[model samples]
Each structure stands twice: as structure tokens, then as C-alpha cells.
Target: MIVVLLAFTLASFWALIAWKGMQERALAFAKAGSETQGLTHSLAQHASKSFNAVALALFGAGQYILHSDKSARASAEINDLLAQYAKNIPQVREIGVLAENGDWMFSSFETVPAVNNGDRDYFRYHRDHPEDETPRISEPLTSRVTGRPTLLMTQRLSNPDGSFGGVIFAAIDLAYFRSFYAEFEADLNRTVTLMKTNGKVLVHRRDDQVGKDMTGTALFSGRLKDAGTGLYSIVSPFDGRTKQFAYERLSDFPIVISVAVAEDTILDGWRGDRRFDLLLGAAISTILIGLAVVLALQTRKRSVMARMLRERERGYRLLAENVEDVVTRIDMDGRRLYVSPSIEKLLGWSADEIIRESAYSNIHPAHRELIKGLIGQLGAQNRTATCEYMTRRRDGNYVWVEAQLNFVQDPDEPTAEIVGAIRDISKRKAAEEQLVAANEQLKALSETDPLTGLANRRRFDRMFDAEFKRCQRSGSQLSVLFIDIDKFKSFNDTYGHSAGDDCIRQVAGALASCLKRPADLVARYGGEEFAVLLPETAAINAEVVAEAARNAVHDLAIQHHGSPDGSVTISVGVAGGKCDARNSTSSMLAAADGALYLAKEQGRNRVCVAAENPSLTLVRPAG
Candidate 1:
């Protein structure tokens, strides 16, 4: 019966520990899944922004160069503009502008024939649906000019009188993303995928699959439609293997990015860890069983028990007095029947004084109730327990101590005395707290931008995602502003790059200062461009913010001989929309980018808000 009871207790304890370890392992996997999703989402976010920027820049260049002039001079200007855009973007094979009749009027390439594109889906979509002015992104198709498979993006070109003039098209090479995945997945048990919202797969690294239609798959019809980002475990229909998927639905572009790792790979170490824990528990239990038998046999030698008990009592008392730990004995009523001399050294209280004073009164008030509860159980038959608590010291300070206790029957009396030992663990506890503080500080530093001493781009992305999610639930509006230091390249050319960096720092500081709301975030979006994300803000309020940021930079009055203003000034674009299921942050950024471009065109150092989606007409000159 004793053996059965012992085995059961050990098994229960081991099971509890095993369950806790499993929870930790599961939490680790969950964190890894989130990181994987973030990796893929980041890549997609950068690529999408690059595409938007290149498209807008090219369109702006075309309009500025070809306004009312289809002459050779204007064609030359368009060629130059496209050259600049294409040089920066490696994925673009060709950029072209078409006339209203769908005839290619100019190409970025040096010598190219004027081809007709009236039958193209992108061109036809813009001509038929002029109201939907957003950039039309099409699936991969063979390009007539480049003769290579490409993904096309087009924006409608309007004349000065607000009439439809033509369409500007840029063909992005699909192999660029495919090659990127090849490099991104190096020797890891991972697959990177890029697919359109229509369930058309553009690139899938593992199977070398491209342009596969996956509209019938549960992955798209189920979780992908609702969640912006999530982790899922399912058996792949294509490969018939269980895989963990970390997927993100891009907010602005109708695209989804997925990173998949096999279920076996993710759980490889956890199973081994569980097995090791079980084996360790078994070994300890076996040792404990052997020790228990020896102790029980020794306890049955009744003839010499009294003599041995006396010798052991003396030896225990001597050892207790010499040790740093304080030993104590209490009766069932909770009175201190015996106190070790070590109490004076450990707690700054004499044994006689501890016995005379209120028993256990020096325990911290916050922990007194817990100690009382534990003390009540000291009357249980031979049951041992351990707990840690903070106790008041002689100097009115608190010290942490770990206490181990058991109830022992008194030979001369009917009652049992609770024997206990208390060890100082204050140093260990302090070290743990210090380690936690250091980790928090390191994490904060990693998220902070060193140059401007503000939240960096990575941190901004995280905050934007979280706040956007919150606004969606609360039915609130989110406003975003894109700011750029006008004529920054000329600033670097006139002054050195060092001076240019100072100008950027000054601009970042000014932009941050203009924001009064705690929910507003300003981050350096690489180089001279900065972004301010405002949560729960309306268009009116955001307009005020954008104008303020522009003036703030102008107020700096930093000299720039190359700029028309002869001083550093910024162009700000503002866009506002409800952060809900129907809208994405990227759309807001695109609108703001268009507005900022308008500000630059209307004249540098101005603020413009989106007149409507995909266009900015109203301009508020910088004050």
C-alpha cells in the first residue's frame, strides 16, 4: 500500500512538471510561427511599397514631361524619367505610356516600336472603369515588348482638363520574386509562397510551382479571408504532409504571403525533451524508492532506538546551530516551542526573544495570510511542503527566504511539532529581477532608432499593425502622412553626406515635435522620407497635422542653396480612412504618396490631402 501511494504521488508530480514543460514548448512554437509570418510579411510589404513608389514616380514624370506636348523633346523627357524609375527598380523590364486610342506613344527603351495594347486586360480595365482609379495589378502574362512573362501594373493618365488621356504601364518580372524565394529559403525546412487574393499562386518555392490556381483550397476559403496574419496547421493537399503555415494578407495589395514549415521539423526537439524528462523522473523515483526502504528498515530497530535518538538529537541541534539556515519547531496551536540559536545571526533576533515575542510577527504583511494558510497544514500527518516568502528584517527591510517544513511526532507528548528550515534566497531573487530588467532594456534599444532617438521602422511597423487592428475593432478612423524633405539629393551634393545626415536628423526631430497626440507615431521611412501614423484621427485633424509638420520643417530654416526655397522644407501628403476589414494601411500610404507627389508638383514645401482615392487635387501651400 505504501509503495502504491509513493508511486502515485511521484507520478502525479512528474506529470504536473511534464505538462508545464509542454506548455512552454507550445508557447515557443507559437512565437516562432509569428516570427515566420513577420519575415514573409516584411518582404512583401517592402516589395509592394517599391512597386507603388516606382509607379507613381513614373506617372508623375510622364505627366510633367508630356503635358500638352507630344513632340520629340517631350518624348526625350519621358525617356529620361522612365530611365530614372527603371534604374532604381530591377524588377521592371519596361515602362511605357499609351495614347487614348491604346497605341503605345513612348517607351523607356532607347529604340522600340509603337505597339498597340487595346486588348490588354489592364488597359481595358482602366478605360472601362474610370471611376476605380486604383492601380490595376494583373496576373503574370507574356509581355509583347519584353517577350518574357511579367506581372503588369497600370495607372490611368488624365489630361490637364481632367479628361482621360491614356494609361501608363510597367511590367515587373515574375522571376525576380522566384529568385528571391530561392535565396530566402537556404537549407531550412521552409517554403515561401506569394499568391494573389484571387487564389492564383505566383510563386511557391518548394514545389517550384508558379501560376497555379488554388481557389478551391480550404486555406484560402477559411482563415485567409478573415485574418490579416495567422498561423495554421494542416495537411497540404498537394504534398500530403502536415505543415504549419504562417500567412499574412497584405492590407494594401490584394496579395497573401505564406511561409510553411513541416510539422515534424517544428516539433523535432519537443518530443525528445519530453522523453528525457520522463526518464529523469523515473531515475529519481527509483532512487527515492531504494532510500525509502533503507530508512524504513533502520526505523524498525526498536532495541537501540532511544540511544540512537538521543545521539541524533544532539547532533542535529549542533548542526542546526552552526548552519546559516534558521531551524524552528512549532506546536499545533502555532506557538514557537523551540527556536534555533542561528535565528540571531540570520534574522537579528535571539532565540529567547523570538519565543517571547509574537510568533511569526516579523513576516511581511503582504505574505502573512499565505504563511498562516501554510502553517495551518503543519498539523497534517508527516506531510512535507515548501514555499518561499519575504520576511521583515531587523533593519525594517525585507528578505526573501525559502522554507521547507514537516510535522514530527513528539516522543514525550500526544501532539506533533512542526520542524522547518529557512534559507536566505534574497541574492538569487535580486539577480533574477536584474536579469529581467536588463532584457527589457535590450529589447527597447533594439526597437529604437539611434539617429533620431525615436521608434525605428521595425517598431513603427509593429505599432501600426497593432493600432490598425485595434481601430478595426473599435470602428475608428486611422490617418497616415507621408513626409519627404524636398530636394534632399541636391542638399547632399552641395553639402557632404554628413551634412545631409544632419538635415535628415533635423527633419525627423521637427516632424516628431509637430505631433501632439500620444497615439501619433513618426518614423524615418528610410533616407529623407518620414511617415507619421495617427490612430483615431479624422481627415480634418490629419490635415491639420500634415500642415503643421510642413511648417515645422520650414521653420528650421536650414540653408539649402540647391533648393528653390534656399532652405530645408518638407512636402506632406495626408490620407484618412476607417481601419476596418474593407481598407488597408497600404492603401492609405498610397493615397498619401500621391498627395505628397502633388505637393511637390504644385511647388515644393506644400501639404496636400487626397481629393479622392488614388488622386490628390487640393493643395494647401506651406505656411
Candidate 2:
């Protein structure tokens, strides 16, 4: 019976060790999955931004060709414009404009090469599907001129009659993406892949695998088919090793990014832990067997207890010394009874010094009360309390740290003590701040026009709605100005598209300079048209500002032979009133638009004011 009992105890010990080993294995894989997901997300963002920049260049070049003289298609100005775009955007290798027949019209290359992309997939697709104006990203292909692997981002250009005009494309070197991915490849078995949604790999760390077809793989048929982003495990065909993968699809482009790590690599630490646990269980089994044999010996039992106590103390000391966070014990009087040696590494304060001072001394003055409140909760409710606050280090700099406090009761003592663990969380705090700043920058970019540096139409509409509601609530006056550059299309025809862009920029600057109040908003309402919102301004004031803006543009003295004034000029229309149930934003816009039509009819380069009724108007004569 004694032997059976001893055997049963040994079996249970081994069983418990096995359970813990299983848990550790699961935890290892979970951690790997989380890391892969984060990496994939970051890679997707990078790829999306890079592709968007290329698309912007393509769009600008296409618009320029659509509006400019066809005779200047091969001019030096076109080449210089494309070259400037390539120089500014690091990802783009070259920018080119192709004719409807796939002949290269202009390129950023110093020497123009006679290359025909008539056989290219992007060109053929755009030609065949004339209505599809969305930008197309082609599979990896060798460039005709450079002979380097490149991905083409192409957008179809359209004529005034909506017919297919041509295709404008930007070449992005595959090596650019490969180099960026190389930074994240710290291990040999780790891989980063950028591929098309159709399974053709565009860029890969393994050059040989680039352009490989993966459509039949489980990653495409099972995981990606179900969702845009996901995690899965698969046996790699390259090395026949099982790998865990996380993938994310670009939000604005038809591209996918994947990060993978070998399963064996992820579980290496778990395997080591399992071996150590087996040795520990064997030693404990032997000790139990010997104790069972000497069951009647009480003297040996006392010695065994002493040895076990010493072993436990050694194990605890090792754990405390090796842990990254500081382990601490505090008495009821808020004094540190013990502090782990890691405190020195975390805060530049020695363990002995920390124990000598009050526990709250290093905490920031503003955060001291917060920590005290958490401590009170731990003592009063016998519960755990977690808090994050700034703590001053011995070097006189404050670092963010998180602390978890728990009440620990000693059976033999009258009072309970607090056990706490503190970890330096400065990196996490910094990351949070950076995320907030990025979000603000993204918002700003979304609301502003890239060319003129003024608010875009979307921003104007939003502000219009907000201000309209505010005027209705407060009974304050709201005014709007609709301004147009006279004969802007003829101006573009007189000067090239490049000069037209310059004129628009100059006019935008002059108009912006005329507004003085913080509540005023100037936006590029559309092509050659600008809108201004003036809150708390009356109709007369709006007309005055509009006249100043018209005069401001005339003062620019930019040569515009298309205008009767013999130079660049503007026509302004002003509308203002208190918004009511009947007078809405749309109504205000219509009234302003009518006045603008009248200003142009009476002749260009003047301001027109509209009454509360949208049809009734008065024109301010041109100076």
C-alpha cells in the first residue's frame, strides 16, 4: 500500500508538469501570432502609402496630358515635370506617359528611349476596358529600359468626350520593397512577402520566389478567401517546415502583405523548459520515495523540512533577481520593506536606497495622490489595484511606469503587508503618443488640398454644415463667397497646363491673404473655382472682402491673354443671412452661385451681392 501511494504521488507530479508544458507551448505560439499580426499591419500601411504616392503622380500626369496641347507631348517641360516627380518620390523609379497606341510619349529618363509598351498587361487592360478608370497595379515585370524588375501603377486618361485618351504609369522598383522588408527580417526562417490579390508575388525576401503563383495554396483558397486579414499555419513548400503566418490586405489597394515565422523557431524555448521540468519531476520523485522509506524517522523529517525551506528561499531569490520588473514589499505604514535588485536597473536607484526612503517619494507630485488612492483600495478591500503613472528616476528624469498592488496577509502577523510589482512602461506610453499624433496628421491631410494647400471641397461641406447649424442656434450672420477665375479654360489653352497650375496657386495665395478672421475658411471648391465661409459677417462685409480678393488677384499681374483685363482677374459673388428653417446651406449656395452668374454676365472681375431671396442681387462695379 505504501509503494502504491508513493507511485500515485509520483504520477501526479509528472502529470502536473506535463500540463504546465502544454500551457507554455500554447503561450509561445500565441505570442508568435501576435507579433506576426503587428508586423503585417505595419507592412500593409507602408505599402499602401507608397502605392498612393505613385498613383498621385500618375493622376497628375494624366490630367496634364488631357488638358495640354498634344503637340507638346514630347517637350522638355513634360520630361522635366516627370523627372521632378520621380526625384521627390523615393519609391518611384520612373514616370512615363504613353500614347493611345502604347508608344512612349514622354519619360523621366535623361535620354528618351524608343520603347513601346503595346504588349504590357496594364496598357492592354486600360485600352480594352476604357471605362475602368481605377488605377491598376500590374504583376512584377522586367522594365524594357532598365531591365530591372518593376511593378507598374497605371491610370487611364480620358478625353473631353469621355473616350480613352491614353495611359499614364509609374514604375516602382521591386528592389525598393525588398529592401524595406529586409529591415524586419531578423531571422533566417522569418519571411516578408508582398503579393497581388490574385496570388502573384511582387516582392519577396527570397528572390527566387518572386512572381511565383500561389493561387492553389491554402493561404489563398482558405484564409484569404474568408477575410482580408487573418492568421494561419501551414507547411512551407520551400523548406517543408511548418510556419505560422499573419496577413493583411491594403485598405486602398489590391495588394496583400504577409509575415511568417517557423513553428520550430517559436517553440525552441518551450522545448528547453519541458526538458528542465522533466529533470525537476524526477528529482522530486526520488525525494518522495526516500521520505516514504523513512516514514517512522521524525529526526530526519526535521532535517528534510530545513533543506526544503532553504531550497525554496534560493528559488525565490533567483526568480526575484532575474525578473525584468521590480518586486517589492511594503508595510502598512507605506514604507518599502524589501525591493528587488531589478529596481536599480529600472530607476537608477539601488535596492537598499529604495528601501530606505518612503515608497511615494519617487512618484511624481501629481501622481502621488493617485497611487495613494490605489493603495488605500488594496488595504481596505483586500483586492488588487493596478495603476500607471510617471515616476522620477535618480537621474532627475521622469519615466512612465505601471504598478500592480495586492494585499498579502501573514498568518502569524497582526497586520497585513502590500506586495507590489512595478514595470517601466515608457515605450508603451511613447507609442500611444505617436499614434495620436499620426491620427491628427492623417486628419489634416484628409481635409486639405495637396496642390493649393487650402481646404478641399469635402472640408468645406463639413464646415458649411457645422456653421449653418451654429448660426441657426445663435441667430448670428453667416456669409459665403463663390469666386471664379475668368476664362480659366482659355488661360490653360494660352499657357500650358504647368503654367495654369502656377496661376491657380498664385490666385489661391492672394485670396487667402485677404481673409483676416479666424472663423473664415477658404477652400478649392472645384476646378478653377474657390469658396469662402465667413462666420458672424454681414452681407456688406462679405462684399468688401470679395472685392478685396478680386483686386488681390488682379494685383498678382500674372499674364493671362485670355482675359479682357489683359492679365489674371477674378469674379466674386457674395451671399449672407441668418440661417432659418427656410434658408438652408443649399439655398445659400444657390443664391451665391446665381450672384456669381450675374457678376460674370455684367462682365468679369467684379463682385455681386445676393439678397435673402436668392434671385435678387446687386453687383459691385470693377475698380
User: Candidate 1 on 268-339: residue-level lDDT in tens?
Assistant: 777788788778887988887887687667755754876876786897788888888899887766688668
Estimate every model's Cα lDDT from 0 to 1: 0.78, 0.86
Best by TM-score: 2
> What clash count goes with each model?
0, 0
Best model per lDDT: 2
* Regions of candidate 2 where Cα sits further than 4 Å from its true position: 1-11, 70-74, 287-296, 299-623
**Candidate 1: clashing pairs of residues:** none
TM-score of each: 0.52, 0.53
User: Looking at model 1, how many pairs of residues clash?
Assistant: 0
